[model samples]
Target: LKGQIHGGVAQGLGQALMERVVYDRQSGQNLTGSFMDYSMPRADTMPDMEIFSNPVPTKRNPLGAKGAGEAGTVGALPAVVNAVLDALAPLGVKTFDMPATSERIWQAIEEARA
Candidate 1:
């Protein structure tokens, strides 16, 4: 479920620093339209991820094994965003608005340049 991991992180990143879904006042429609119009995380934006967690729980029927699903997504969001910040730290780019689009990144880059 690489898609799930990626998608969850995308959602988390949206919640973290980007524009989230909100109602359109005039048309009463969703603000985010198509995938292209949407602000999404890009491939080069994130660093490698390290995932780890405690063993499956044992609370039900002597076998409380936790599901493997949702685990990766749970682990990936923070790691990816953290890596981005870490990469930009040396440039004094400490803050960002998310989904970290090229436009936003470009603005940050320009700000850093200034």
Candidate 2:
């Protein structure tokens, strides 16, 4: 479950900030078609993750426990995206769309600079 949280946070960060599945408007070729052409999530690109457990068991399960497997992803994704936005807020870049590609981030940075 912990690993799931960490990995999902990392993936969601990439997906929300650095990864994309874009295709060319003219030829319909996916801009991220190849592995080499696609931006991927890497450990060195992220910050350390810390998970806190509330231990307040839920009513949805039989073991006095809620499902942790997918819950971490459900929760961490937002946190990661929000963190990115917060980190970039000083530059007047407050709003962002998903798959926050490098192109997009760079554009926002440029726009902020302008």
Supply the global lDDT for candidate 1: 0.63
User: How does each model score on TM-score?
Assistant: 0.51, 0.62
Clashing pairs in 2: 16-100, 17-100
Full-model lDDT, candidate 2? 0.72
Alpha carbon lDDT at 47, candidate 2: 83
Question: In lDDT terms, which candidate is top?
Answer: 2
lDDT of 2 by residue, 1-114 (tens): 566677777766665666777789999988888888888778887787787666777777787765455455565568767887788899999776776666677787788888
Question: Which model scores highest in TM-score?
Answer: 2
Cα-based lDDT for every prediction = 0.63, 0.72
Worst 10 residues of 2 by lDDT: 66-75
List where candidate 1 sits over 4 angstroms from the true fold. 1-29, 33-59, 62-64
lDDT at 107, model 1: 78
Clash counts per candidate, in order, are 1, 2
